[model samples]
Target: MGVVYIGDRAVGKTHLALELTSPQGNYVRVFLANQNYQNLRANLLNLDGTTKPTQTIEKRSLNVEVRLPIGISKIAVDWIDSPGELFRRSWQSEHINEWENFKEMVGKSEGIFLIVPPYREILQPHIESENYVTQQQWCNRFNRWAEFFIYDCSQARRIVICLHKADLINCEIEQEISKLNYLPHGSPLNWLQRHNYVVNNYFQPVKSELEKINKSRSGLSVRCFITSIYYRSLLELPWIYLASYL
Candidate 1:
């Protein structure tokens, strides 16, 4: 199966990929075998705060064996990590071939991991700056991505809307979940309900837009998750969800 992780510049998509495919990384427990990530690890091993953004797309192949209700099934995953800027509209004109290649990859892929960061800190009070992207701007960007999938990648079966970098908003979310009068048994929907604030505050606009789009043309199985590399279990939830499809 083909899969891709899409996100904005500096939003941690590469970091998340590095951690997922790392042998010594926290997510090692989720994978039965991930020996082919050596090349990917070598390329990203020197990543740090000063690391430049990915300029070209990179692919990592793995035979992921996961337990299903039927039995053990091995899923061959061609995981693609692309340059964030390449997905933006502005870059489409500048990098024509790379941009088309990305769309083609998405069209052939079975799943997409849309990695998005928390917005609270992003929307915090700050001086007006050219680099600043407001919530509306984000919604616009995400909306465009949704349209791309709808029109360009109709073969995609699953869409994982990941609220990544959750470590940054974990405490506040826990407090909000604690205040809830009723909490259901564990599940993705229940988890979303428990962390309603994260949805309502951070992802509502995109969620609403997605709903509207889905109503018109439906087929995509959408799932949401609050992920963080700092929390191993949390980091693995999205992958587990993806595995369920297998």
Candidate 2:
């Protein structure tokens, strides 16, 4: 069993996957991008500022697998890091046949990691600007795509919503949770209950959107989580929860 990361461009999907699967430890990681070999290599080199003479990584599109031991047992995770920009733009094609083809390809994934930047709270403004599709349209497209992926793969329960760049808003969530507990009629005995309520409220809108998708995409389950690659402490709880699930 493994997890798949899906998000818009430069959302740190590759970086998070690498950190989780790094060889320095005992995690096995693989990268699957939508681009062809030549383009992938150029992007990596440009992003890393590596010298052309010392580029040792292969510039090819292949499924490379790695194995690592977890305590006495071993687990294999397959990671797919596709081009977010391409996926989003592919929806704008004029040909219905081509659009269906693209949708069919994405529907094969095991799970989805929907990454949204914390700084970009509302979806409307971002989607309305040039060089991007409207937020409403993006949500609709994702809903349909997710529905297809779940129906085809039979693994909709693994969907995870990741609020990336959450370090910027971690303190806010904490404060909000605390404040909710102290509300006029909030709970008195269970702090967890209060925290859960606060978290749910914070994500209520996204959850509603997901619910609309779920109606059509029936077997799929969606869960929300906050994550920040740059914040070590912010990741502790999420990692612990994931470890328990593993």
Candidate 3:
């Protein structure tokens, strides 16, 4: 089995990959940083803060792979972790090259794990110009790439979308409540109503966007899951789902 991470930069792709590898008892880990040949060579020489500190905490980096053990079966998982900030102007060349490499890896992949933050939509700019692309366009491009890979692979693989940082939403709600309380005549009911609107109108759209992307694709099985490292119960969903495939 193969696993690939697809998303914009700093979205916890690498972190999630490490978590999966750490739990699987018999797995040989490999790093495939989204750096040039020269940079990757240097990265090997500088192994500071690379390995996981404990079983609970997972490390995040550019790219990594792990070989899984399947008794009497020749089963293995090659995880391809790409850079999160793919469209940065300074790293455009590296981004394109890494994406090409990602495509090649996906051709042989049996599964894909896509990670996107719930609050990212609110933070990303809605810019459109010769030099800038809207977040929606970027998302569409990402979906298209995944669609192509899923289309190419013959094995019936699982596609999981990890809605990371769900806890952050709760935190944001609390922060808003605190801010509202400073008002001379603040009302808890009013604050709750405002926060509920934000949750329904803002974060809910993310689910709709993903469902739209999945509906357009054929043959591949897709599952959306909400997760937080702090929330043990939610983390189990992805693990249980992945195990079903094995």
Candidate 4:
């Protein structure tokens, strides 16, 4: 499957992709991007779950090709890890060559990982009021972009709303959880942890938009995945994105 990862900067998009595709000895990984990273291999493929590079030169996107041997047939998967600026600048603005490249990738994508920050971060307000308003408008535009890919792109089969930075959310939930242990039996902490309240709240807006797409498209699927590159393993099974792809 051709999977493209799109998200704003510093949301751990590249980290998650590299973590999922790290050396299993069954795949040959290659980079097709034109930009240079300070320490791409160590930063991305860190086994200890390191999520940040010393410094990134800030490229428009990072492209990866993973060739996996499925029996005798070697299947190649192309992943485009794009910077959020692509969407920020391209929205209601000039569609530059980079934007065109992004469009083509999305057009040919079989599955897409639209990465966004955690619930609390998403709910946080922009410092500038005008920028906040612009962001809301851009979100609508992004929804339209998503609609185009789902309805018009024949190869687009699935769109997964990936909630990035699960580690942070887990910490938040745990902190709030500790205070509730003194309460009566059957405290809300149990429900919050069990139901994945942070992720569920963050996914609601995307779910509402894509529920229509799911209904309209006979075979198209819109789903959600919560992930964290920092955690050694997952508290919940869904945080492991490799399973989602394979």
TM-score of each: 0.74, 0.52, 0.50, 0.55
How would the candidate models be sorted by TM-score, starting from the highest? 1, 4, 2, 3
Report residue 158 deviation for candidate 4 (angstroms).
2.2
- Across residues 1-246, which tens digit of lDDT does each residue of candidate 4 receive? 456556655566666655544443223233435423334656454676555542312333434433323222222345455444454654426646656666776777676656665543343343323322243553565586566665656676666565666555534644433432322234445423522453355555555565676776676766555556554232122322222343
lDDT of 1 by residue, 71-100 (tens): 555555665666667656688888788778
Checking candidate 2 for backbone clashes, the offending pairs are: 127-134
Itemize residue pairs with steric clashes in candidate 3: 8-84, 9-84, 9-85
lDDT of 2 by residue, 123-215 (tens): 334343343444455555456445544455454445556656554553564553334332213334243453254347545544555565456
Top-scoring candidate (lDDT): 1
Give the local distance difference test score of model 3: 0.47
- Computed on alpha carbons, the lDDT of every model, listed in order, comes to 0.62, 0.44, 0.47, 0.49
For candidate 1, the lDDT comes to: 0.62
Worst 10 residues of 1 by lDDT: 176-185
Which is the leading candidate under TM-score?
1
Model 3, which residues run further than 4 Å from truth? 17-75, 85-97, 120-156, 171-203, 206-218
